[model samples]
Target: MRIGFVGGGKVATAFGRYLHAHGLAVSNYYDRHEDKLSHACRLTGAHPCQSAAEVAKMSDMVLITTRDDQIEGVCRDLADHGVIRKDHLVGHMSGAHPSLILHDAARQGAAIFSLHPLQAFAEEEKALADLPGTYFSIEGTDPRLASVEEIMAKTGNRFFRLLPEHKRLYHLSACIFSNYLVTLMACGLEALSHSGIHPEDGFPAMMPLIQGTIDNIARLGPPKSLTGPIARGDVTTIEAHLTAMADPSLASLRQFYAFMGLKTLDLAIEDVLQDPLKANALKKVLEMG
Candidate 1:
């Protein structure tokens, strides 16, 4: 299907380029940023449109890749211009918002859809090339959804449905996995820094181990996938971690350690071979913070 992109920003540009690469026509590109529009056109070999209406005028599918706050304005503009029609398929890449956010498009007779990639987009070029392997959260009604999923599958990405009402929860789960994993790594780096390890040297040192843990999680499943101090129920080791980081310089680290330990105790109760006394002791220590 011919796809028209309504924003030349990172997600729109990358996704447009990917569709083009897969022999799909990224028929038109539009953006407020002239440079981004030019760049998108350059990369996708697509024509640049002066406005969203110009884009909608030429394509069967329209992807609104604007910022979360801007989606409504863009849709309103499309509605005002009478640019959308029943034959069009409208989608957005936002995760926090559900497909219902595009109600203006729906009112204009377009089929509404939402597709959110479960990966970060640090660079446009890299995102475009890597998107084919990413997982996407998709939600819509019936044959439109089925068709979109088929197209997504052709890009070598996995697509799964989410109920509109559950979109926030689904997106929050990804945020914990992707965003909080970065936070977890930063904490690890800080703890290592207390031992005189530079952040620069620390990341490379931890990279293999971190990647291996992730691979193991993929292979072994959660709970069973867990390892280290908490998994082993090594209270002494965990205590040492807390005690070592109790100084003022590591106040945040101490707090986080306590919070994670509390959560870990819960995991241990579910997954570990635990003595009642030992579990109660671990719970007490973690709760003391």
Candidate 2:
């Protein structure tokens, strides 16, 4: 099938280049930003289009790769232009949105869907390299969902289907895994600063530990990989941590640590073998802050 793009940004450009590599027809790149359109067209070997409606008119499928906030409005614009055919497929790459966000296109008799890659898209070059191992989550009309699966399969990607009702939960986990992980790392940097360690020295020092944890998690999963104070129910060690962060300026950091510890404590109790009394005592220590 000929795939066209409505917004030639990172996702659009990456997918176009990735798909084109897999022997699929990719063309009709479109974006309000002329540079983006040219960039996508250059990388994908696609023809740049004058307008979004022109892209929809020219391809069998139109992927709206704009920001999440703009996807529904872009679909409405295509619908208003009355260009999408009854058999054409319309989709967006927003992880948080349900396929129903494309109702405007669906109203015009096009099949609409959502396709999200479970990876970060920082650079087109990196995205292309990452796409091969990336999994996709798809949701849409059941009959039309097969097309998405076909694309996943043809591009050597594995994917799972999701119900619209579960999309928010799935996306929320992604937000925590990606965005909140970065926040947690920043918190570690702050902790180092209190001890007079420069962020430059601290960040590099933490890299190996961060990578080791990731490796452990990949092999044993989070619950089984956990090995910190909470996992061992080491109440005295945990108490020392809390006491050290008692300064007024460190209140926020202390609170964050306590909050995360309580959550981690639950995981430790459920998944790790530990003395019941020690676990209870550790819980109390974490709760005290």
Candidate 3:
């Protein structure tokens, strides 16, 4: 199939190069930025088009690799130029929005879809090589999507369908796991630094424990997977933590700790029988908040 890319930036470069490396025909590419066009053309050895119309007109499939907010505008541009053919397959690579944003392309008689890889692309070479292990959340009802599935499978990536309505929440879950976890780690590093531990020195020490906890979650599931103070129903340990950090500055952290402790206690109560005395102590401390 003759494939073309619009907005040939890092993602376009990565996908185009990876596809061509795996023996797919990446016909041409187009980008508003001359530098991006030059770089992508050099990487994929594909011709660069001077206009979006040119790329859309030449290819059977067109991937809109622009920013999420620009997708609709680009689709409208293709429609205005009468560039998209009735049977052309068009898609974007945005995770936050669904394929419905490409409705203009569909209205132009093109088959539209969204296929987002659940991986960050900081560099083209590394991303192209590692992208195959990435999972894709795809959304659309186009019959030609079968061809997309075949090509994605060639990359050895997993593909799962996501309804348009579920797109935001599905992406939100990914953000919590990937992005928010980074934020969580940042908080941990700050807390360690506040206690006079050098962040660079401390972070590495936590990596193995974090990896082990992740493995436990995978194997045993939550509640059962939880360990440490609250899981053990160590009310004395909890009170000592609350008492040791009773300063006003640590009040917020203490509250957060107690809230999380109460949550874990609930999980333990459901999954593990706890000593009645220790349970009562924890409940009293948590209730003091």
Winning model by TM-score = 2
Top candidate (lDDT)? 2
Off by over 4 Å in 3: 262-270, 273-289
lDDT of 3 at 96: 90
Writing each residue's lDDT as its tens digit, candidate 1 over 1-289 gives 8788888899988888888888888888999899999999998989999999999899888888988998878988897899898888888899888888889999988888899998788898788768867889898773666768878867878878988889999989989988998899989988888899999998998899988988987997667767787777677887787788777988888899899888877876777636777777777777775
Error of 1 at 54 (Å): 1.1
The alpha-carbon root-mean-square deviation between model 2 and the true structure, to one decimal in Å, is: 1.3
- Candidate 2 Cα lDDT to native: 0.89
Model 1 — TM-score against the truth?
0.95
Clashes of each: 0, 0, 0
TM-score versus the correct structure, for each prediction: 0.95, 0.96, 0.90
Worst 10-residue lDDT window for candidate 3 reads: 270-279
Checking candidate 2 for backbone clashes, the offending pairs are: none
lDDT string for model 3 (17-112, tens) is: 888888888889988899999988887888889988899888998899988788889989998888878889999988898888888888888888
Clash count, candidate 3: 0
List model 2 lDDT by residue over 102-171, tens digit each.
Answer: 9988888888888999999998789889999999998886487688788888998999788888888999
